[model samples]
Target: MKKLLKYSAFGLGGLVGLMLIVVAIVAATFNPNDYKQQIIDLVQAKKSRTLKLDGDIKLAFWPKIGANLGKVSLSEHKGSAEFAAVDSVKVSLALLPLLKKELIVDTVYVDGVRANIVKYKDGTTNFDDLLSKDEEESQTIKFDIDGVNVTNSAANYSDEGTGAKYSISKLNLKSGHVALAEPIDLETDFTVTANQPAVAANAKLKGNFLVDPATKHFVAKGLDASIKGDLLGGKDVDITASGDIDAKPDTKEFLINSLKLAATGQFSGAKLTIDLSAPELKALKDEVTSKEAKVSLVQEKGSDTFKANLVLADIKGSPKALQSSGITGDISGVQGKRTISGKFSSPFIGNLENLIFDLPKLAGNLDIKDPALPNGGVKGNFNLTLHADAKQELVDSKFDLKVDSTQLNGDVAVASFTKPNIKFNLNADTLDLNKLLGTSSAANPAEKTAANQKPADLSALKNLLLDGKIKIGNLIYQKYRLSGLNVGIKADGTKLALTGLNVKLDDSQIKGNLAISQFAKPLYTFDIDIDRLDVDRYVTANTGATPAATKTSDKPLDLSALKALNADGSLRIGSLKYGKTKASNIRIDLKADGQKLSLNPLAAKVDDSQINASIGISRFSDPIYSFNVNIDKLDADKYITKSDPNSKSPAAKSTGDTPIDLSALKKLNASGEAKIGWLKLANVKTENVSIGLKAADGIATVSPFSANLYQGNMS
Candidate 1:
């Protein structure tokens, strides 16, 4: 028609130029290392398994597309599978028209892939049963992405029920896939290494994965994580956190739905938020170590409630009982969800060897609830009032707690508990007894130089702080001491009760009542009552004595009591006016057992002697006697042969009785028995010339023995 349209366009341009030279001679023999062994035999024939390649399997792509096996081996049944680094894999064929699949994966660049995921301890797995079954269904595929890199991956974990094994080494990850032909999108980066060190350094974690191909259900966003280390012993921590997670699509057992958490960020940022619908898990994160929980925690075993607003910054892989320890803020009431509240705002700095004690920089608001965990949980309760300051190791106390509660039942050890706990009201107030005797100054400074030096080597025995204040009533820390100590002083073993047990070196005050019923057969009881509140600076710092006057015993003395409450000795308070001696109106009703003291008939008008006594103080020469005295009246020859003389009685030993000096009878034993009644009779006292002598310091005058003298035996 126009020469047949120019020979039909030159015979179709010579048949399209001979079909582009026969496709450039089949793309020039198409040999790019034979298409990289046809992509390693098409990924070993769709993973029929077996694939090993170390370099040389490359196809720089441009016509050869992509292929770089580099270092590879994919067996997977549980072991023998190493990609060790692929970094380049871009196979191609499907360019998407409508939906076609010639097995195309336009991109796959893996880097340093060293994956070792095991599951033994009996769970058995080396990837057991390696991926199978995929009857072809690429609802449209033609990927396009180039990103994959992982390094130093190590993950080891075992769990033969409870033997538990752990390991997770340096891992750095990066994954990618999203050239979106649809249905395959991924991007990940994970780096976590603990115990294997590096600990992510002050750490910052990120996690967010979404999957909902209709309902595979997995929508995690802003995932959070936190960690710090060494807190209990104190020092160095910068913790942080962030959160949001989900898992619950019908349960394969990954039930943790939507949560929110937060934490500051100046080194380690921190935050924690938990959701409930929980049925179980929390022994820190129950994978189960078994103390036999969940019956509600074992049927209301008690204690667990806590309110928090924490500030944990220096946190890192803890669990050596919380390495060094940590506790910061928010507590109004807490009983059992376990809240030991510390880092020390006031547990009286509870000497854990007192490094510096911290943790209670609290912001109040706490609650505890325990007693509901025999199986279903919620049986933990505890309430605590907060206010703590005082540290030299710790003192300056104030604790007020009410308890129809007690539950730290991860089964005990917080100082030991066997259950059966109750304290309707517990109150520990202002106790700075020199930091419980550790030489307080808030201790610290190495416990103030080890409470003032002295520890080159001493095994065991470290707790010692005889401070004060303890007004308990039921008393039962091993038995006894209920009614005896009036209500305090449990003694060296501790129950303590002091109105003012001062000790600033001198100004001491102590009213007595000390008891111990059992500390391995211990029964030291006392009803001691002393005055002169500061008795000559406590007898010049205990027994250097030397005070007969200075109006010093520091006043407060006014003795007039005699009621041993009944163990014998019913009534005998006839003037015990001490200091300047005044045994005066002495009346006695005694019943002493063992060394014997039977003053069943004792009446006295001392010094002027209208005394009637009967005392027997045997042995040691025998004459500390105050046994018979019916002194109806006595001058005792000017009171024992002119008063004053060692009362000279050592002469008679022709087996007749009279030869004292047991240090003159252990220095006249005194109201504490050794001798003393009948107004002292040593030189002579039968009533003045009628004789009356009180041996040198003990006084004893009995000449011709006063006619009123009754029944006696002295020594």
Candidate 2:
């Protein structure tokens, strides 16, 4: 029995040796290059593409059954450009496993592989034919691979429709065992260039994956990726991301769990950093949801830090209908301990047939404090609520705000986005207009420079509409001080109106109403009343310039603004003091229409006398004026006396002939009539005086000039 066993073992050994010898003979004697033509012909017949083998094909039999090919290329069907090319490809297979119907590949090494892909304007790709197959040729093929390694590969893609080109170079990929149900490890590094944006990026990825080939299910864990690039022309960016992903093909569900990302970049010469983390994010065929997310951002140049928390409920809809989807979410943010919370909801999410976006509720509250404010800082809080009607129109909105010593409560409605109807009442204890103008020194240099620059456009204000009432207890505007100021204002496309305007200035009260229209030519109308006014003091206080006592030179007045003015107004002053004139119970009605202006009557009581006058001017280019005056009981002695009571008038002094400037008289044509009831100079008195005067073409004439003086008549 022992002898028989030994002989049998020897036979088995001989059989194994013979098989090895046969493999060796095949590896050495067989030339795979001999069948290259046949292989190329077969590929051309099947795929309708040209194949080229520039180098040689070789086989190996020692550790594994393998094949190596060199310098292989495949041509595009109708173009001279090669579709794919490779410098070398080495494939090895486990010989014994194939007999048992198990494909156990030892390793696959590919080097210097290059591909060029193109998309035509008609949405067809160069590889479209390669991806399509007949029904009979469509069959599932399965295989297992132990490992794969690729190096120095490149791919280029271009889209004619979008005019975008992309290139990938120095691509290296490594993978562990891949099977139908087992986990695999993968790592990749590549550099990508995009022509459309003209940017370049270097990226790396490492992860472990579990894939089910039959079901097309995939899950990835310990996934990490990083990219560094120059974006947006010249901004340097570095981004890192880590996450776990799970996907189900049958249900069309995808979930990302425990995702974290960080980014740092230089934008507009500022260093910016951002960090983000999310607990879970999920997307189904109909809905996308997120549990919680947190984000933090910092800017080095601005010294600003922001943090936010966000939560989203089930949100589902098509892209255009997303606004109507029944989405519920809340977002909160913090900046230096100041907090703001906003919540939003809609009622049309799941209803596919609804096209209207009915926003059922939107509410928010904000509290802010910033050190850059004019008064060191500003503290404020406000609440806002909005609701949309069934037709998806925003109808009723309410706002309540309290900032510093100011309080505003308002309700608003809108017919459309272009027009709004508002009812609001605003009250402020004190508001410094200068402060609100952002005249503080703490403003950024760049921002200040931008503010000082002239704006290129003012077209946005062409469609503005404002209607509101504002009141302030104490206000300081530039050089003016005002108290208990209230104004109701309305503005639309054609006109602006201000009513019920009352303000106290310089211990006096003023009330007025004004209207301005811009439909065609600019026009203005005003009605003003004043209890008392010190014109000189008020003017000096507001203008910061002292009035000159005497004219030093004669210069032409710029009446261009007045030439464009079209105004009609009335002024009533109880008492007015201007320069050396003191007047009481004054009333003036004035009108200006283009280049023509008229003062129908200017009446005032001075001391124990009353005076009335009327004036008119026309021909703006060469003004012509006419005036009429009436005086009752005027004391002429007071006007003739010197301003200094102690000093006497100097004796009459005569010099050489002084030429009169008749040039002014040539421009002016005047005609008037005057009447005086009484006039007295020292002891001489005259009454019942009437005069008529006319001057034109440098000529003066008087008619029916008569006066009763010293109980006698003179003409």
Q: Whose lDDT is greatest here? A: 2
Give me the overall lDDT of model 1.
Answer: 0.37
What tens-digit string does per-residue lDDT give for candidate 2 at 1-715? 9999999999999999999999888878989899999999998988788899988888877757888889999989766679999999999887877666777786799999999999999999998878756667644434689899999999999999999999999999999997768889999999989988787989999999888866788988998999899765546789898999998856657788998998888877667678887778666666656664666666554544444443334344442344333344444444443334444443433222232334444434444433434564445565555554433434566666655665566666664554554445566778765544433344544565322212123333335566778888888766678999999988776667789989998677999998776535556788899999888875543443432333333333234445666778889899988877788988888898777788878898977679899988776544567889898987877667344544453222322364544444443467888888897878689997888878766677777698899789888
Candidate 2 Cα deviation (angstroms), residue 614: 42
Candidate 2, residue 433: CA error in Å? Answer: 9.6
Q: How high a TM-score does candidate 1 get?
A: 0.24
- Per-candidate count of clashing residue pairs (backbone under 3 Å): 165, 1
Cα RMSD of all models vs. native, in order, equals: 24.6, 15.5
Query: Residue 677 in model 2: shift from native, Å?
Result: 50
